[model samples]
Target chain A: MHTAGDVRVEDRDDPEIIEPTDAVIRLTATCVCGSDLWPYRGIEPADHTLMGHEYVGVVEEVGSEVRTVKAGDFVVGSFVISDNTCEICRSGYQSGCVHRAFVAGTIGTQAEKARIPYADGTLVATPGQPDEDLIPSLLAASDVLGTGWYGAVAAEAGPGKTVAVVGDGAVGLMAVLAAKQLGAERIIAMSRHPERQKLARYYGATDIIEERGDAGVAKIKELTGGLGAHSVVEAVGTRESTMQAIGATRPGGHMGFVGVNYDVHIPGFELFLAGIHMEGGPAPVRRFLPELIQLIWDRKIDPGKVFDLELPLEQAAEAYKAMDERRAIKALLRP
Target chain B: MHTAGDVRVEDRDDPEIIEPTDAVIRLTATCVCGSDLWPYRGIEPADHTLMGHEYVGVVEEVGSEVRTVKAGDFVVGSFVISDNTCEICRSGYQSGCVHRAFVAGTIGTQAEKARIPYADGTLVATPGQPDEDLIPSLLAASDVLGTGWYGAVAAEAGPGKTVAVVGDGAVGLMAVLAAKQLGAERIIAMSRHPERQKLARYYGATDIIEERGDAGVAKIKELTGGLGAHSVVEAVGTRESTMQAIGATRPGGHMGFVGVNYDVHIPGFELFLAGIHMEGGPAPVRRFLPELIQLIWDRKIDPGKVFDLELPLEQAAEAYKAMDERRAIKALLRP
Candidate 1:
């Protein structure tokens, strides 16, 4: 990753065990994340920063202190690297651990090899190596799937609840999947694009609203008998998306937003009078990794359908472009 | 209430039961609220709007559908009138009931006689008509104390939590009391006023932060060993207060705010990145009125100390002016 709109497939020195708890991994699969496009679009500063925080990899080497996994073990990881034992981590917020680190901004994962710090806490050893067919789904669990899962959890989605999702990005579609898995009685997906709307239904969206802004909010209200959804997932960080999500939630409802906010501004007058609960940030995906991995391994859930394009690691730029242009919902790169 | 910066206590037609669920109450005591100052400060349009919502009163007359209280019943009421039987009311958010109404901007309680809509849901029958001394405390429950209680509850204050209260006004001070009552292990009050600071400590504040803005946040972080408080109550609605509350709370922590927001803009980037749980708005005071009234009747809590000045109802204008000028923490009016 270089300046805005510039990405290159260049060779670099291979990663090796750097920290006492670090584990070097040989990449098996990685995918472009919706958040990565922020820097790629110049919405954020990239300027040659290490990019990509999602990966499914095979452990190639382990530091002396690494005990959770050994070489040859395939692992699923979260975007945030945490020690997993801090008070914050213990309380299920590994994303805000005392010693947390962002792998995307520090050590890029879209490479042949990457180093995972706090390996035991950040990476989950899969039940042996996964089947090739299941690897993509497992990779999805590393970030997008985990983030979507956290969004549902934060929104308190569960049985008998009506969950509404804003945005049609990969995370939003996966949130539909998560809300379904969480037993939401009904899930509403707000999207206009035909393919994304279809995926939303496949992921268990009971209804899809094609309108945007206030019209979309009115649609949600119309569906919920004018009371609004009980739980709303905001997967878009724009001002309109945030407001729409808040507006679509019932007065005493909960909203969980996981979008990487860029220029969004939420007026306190609206937020205060909205009379809803909200919790969001970089999701503590690590906190939900074990359960998500087990579900994937047991064939209880399939979340990797998001990968609409597949390419070799050498074709990473094209993969990024495909996702950027919305030609593909998501692109999976195999090394 | 007249226009901004003006209030009157002129004679008006006596309120009679106007709705099936209405009850005419002869207020025993009424008080001005921090929020009343919003319109008083010209931030809100208050022309010809009924003013006060906090009161303790005797039921002078009850409509046929008013079954909860009788003509002689003494009641403690919430600021927001709700129908109690609505799905939202049944869900413990009477303030958000489909038929909810604000006592202010519709019908004022500062008058000698006022009509309360949705009597069963809006008013809690006190164990019995109380002594004069308990009137002020009971009046506090109508809004300030209840709002504070809801703030504490929304912030999830509980055992082992370090709770912080922002602002030193009546609501903020009551939040200290609420946090203490909710079993928060540590309560920090952020205030610069010496008298309010003393009251805060007396009300169970374990720490007092006299600094404002970032310095206050630094003090809180320093006090919490750099992890920030587990719960924060924002009683000031300005941008600084909101940010301070957000900053004082640890990631994964909860914050409840009840300030009447004025010109406050929250950048979504900061809110999303804060990684904290937040619930605010017009507090569901009706939900907690019964318990609070019981506590007040039992003499277990003394929220009435907030009333630093007491005067006759004829001095309503003076009372409003005193509170607006910060000459009094709160003012009690006798009809």
Candidate 2:
């Protein structure tokens, strides 16, 4: 990212194995994220910042300590790089691991090649080289898919639960898929976008409510026997969406929020009065990589469908614009 | 409370059965609560408002529809009145029951006689009339002990977990006891008060840190190998205390806040980044009454020690003053 709304595909030296635990991978696919819009729209500062954290690639070189994957191995890595052996990682919060680093600004997965630190701990190699058709799905596993799954799991979505997902972006759609796979009996997708709503249903949303904010909360209550959903997923980090998600969850229910929070301030008294369980943050994608990869490999989930637009790496600017203008749920960039 | 700082025991007609589900109880014991200070301190509006919500008493009369407990039965009731049969109640969130009412503002338990609605669902009868020595303990079960237990449970304190209690008040002390009973491996009590710190140790706190806010959080992290406690209980409702509790919890850990939040506001970005589970509200004390009453009856837990001051009902003003001035952890009033 050169400046606000200025994305350039610039030439740079290929990433190399700089650390004993690092591995360099030739990119197969990478994509723009909703959070990227923060810098693209100038909400967050950008000065030639390396963008894109989601990636699926083939190992090109590995440091002596990178034992998990070898050259020619295809892998999916977490958006947040983590030493999976850390206490936090062992406790299933690799995103907050003692040795953690973000893959976005540092690695710029959208390039031809990138170095992944703590490669053994951050990358999970597929059982074998995946078919071409599975590339996008594998790329989605790098971030959005894993994040949505974490949201659903955090919300405790399961059989007999009524899951309500707030936000109709790629992550929200992925959460709908996760809720379905988690066996939630009912899934309600909150969205005003027709395309996203249609995709939500395909991903197993049993109901759709276009209303938002206070009205959104009321509609959820109206649908859930006046008790609200048993599990709510907040995929938009804005204050209104966060509150709506909380209000839509029944007292004693759970809410999992995964959107990158910007400036949302929650009134403690209101949250206390809501009497709900809440958990959120950057998703521990590394924790779910193995399962997510296997699911995609088996064609049990087609998360790749979330990528409605695809472009070559040279057209990265157009991809960012498409996502920012809501013209695409997500955009895949082939190097 | 009659205006801020003015509490008087005034003469009034004894409460009668106003609802078919009503039961009149002759109070055995009642006590002042921290929340009462809100109105007493003029932070919240007050105008001759009836106070007190914790009580242990003998059933004096039962209306036509009242079941469960008849006249002459000794019982303990939750601070929140709930129709335990409601879906919310059935889901273990009795405080959010469809027909729930706050016992504080409506029917003041700190009286000679009081009418309780939803007798069958709100009050739990003891196995038998308790010995005179058990009165205070039974009264504690009405709110403090129950609320603390809920906090511990909500924080998921259990065998393998290191629990931290933020706040040196009665509820915080009770949470120490709860955490112990729940088998937490370690318990850290954050307090600057010597008396409360000693009480916390007695309640099974393994360590005491005479620090608060950021320093307290740092001490907790230092004690837990720089990972923070696995479970945290927030018994103080202030913004500083809430943030301290959240900060003291490890990534993927749990925090249960039972403090009656006043004007606290939590930054969403911070909470999200913390990657912890949070659950709180007016505790669903009714859900744990059976187990708590049994624990008290079996002499397994003596929660009555939280009350350091005792006075007659006519001395309610002095009791309130003692609590407001921090002269007493809690004050028990004999009606």
Q: Determine the iRMS, in angstroms, of model 1.
A: 0.9
- The positional error of residue A56 in candidate 2, measured at the CA in angstroms, is 0.6
Off by over 4 Å in 1: none
Clashing pairs for model 2 are none
Per-residue CA lDDT of model 2 for A1-335, tens digit only, reads: 98999999999987777889999999999999999998898988899999989999999999998888999999999999999998999999999998888988887888998999999999999999999999999999999999999999999999999999999999999999999999999999999999999999999999999999999999999999999999999998888999999999999999999988778889998898889999999999999999999999999999999999999999999999899989999999999
Model 1, position B4, has a per-residue lDDT of 92
Per-candidate iRMSD: 0.9, 0.7
List model 2 lDDT by residue over B104-127, tens digit each: 988888798889999999999999
Give the per-residue lDDT of model 1 (tens digit) for B1-335. Answer: 68898898777799888888899999999988989899998888877787888888889999898888999999988889888887778888787888878888788888898898888888889887799899889999989999999999999999999999999999999999999999999999998889899899988999899987889889999998888999999998988999999999998999998987777988888887779999999989988988898888888999999999999989989998999989999999998
The sequence of per-residue lDDT tens digits that candidate 1 reaches over residues A1-335 is 88877888888998878788999999999989999889888899888887788999899999999889899999998899899998899999999888888988798999889999999989899989789999989999999899898899999999999999998998998899999999999999999999999999999999999998999999999998888899999998888999999999888899999988888888888887778999999999998899999999999989999998999988988988898899998999998
The TM-score, computed over Cα atoms with residue i paired to residue i, of candidate 2 is 0.98
Tell me the TM-score that candidate 1 gets on chain A alone: 0.99
Model 1 TM-score (2 dp): 0.98
After best superposition, candidate 1 residue B71: deviation in angstroms? 0.4
After superposition, the stretches of candidate 2 with alpha carbons farther than 4 Å from their true spots are none
Each model's total of backbone clashes: 0, 0
Give the Cα lDDT of each candidate.
0.90, 0.93
Per-prediction DockQ comes to 0.83, 0.84
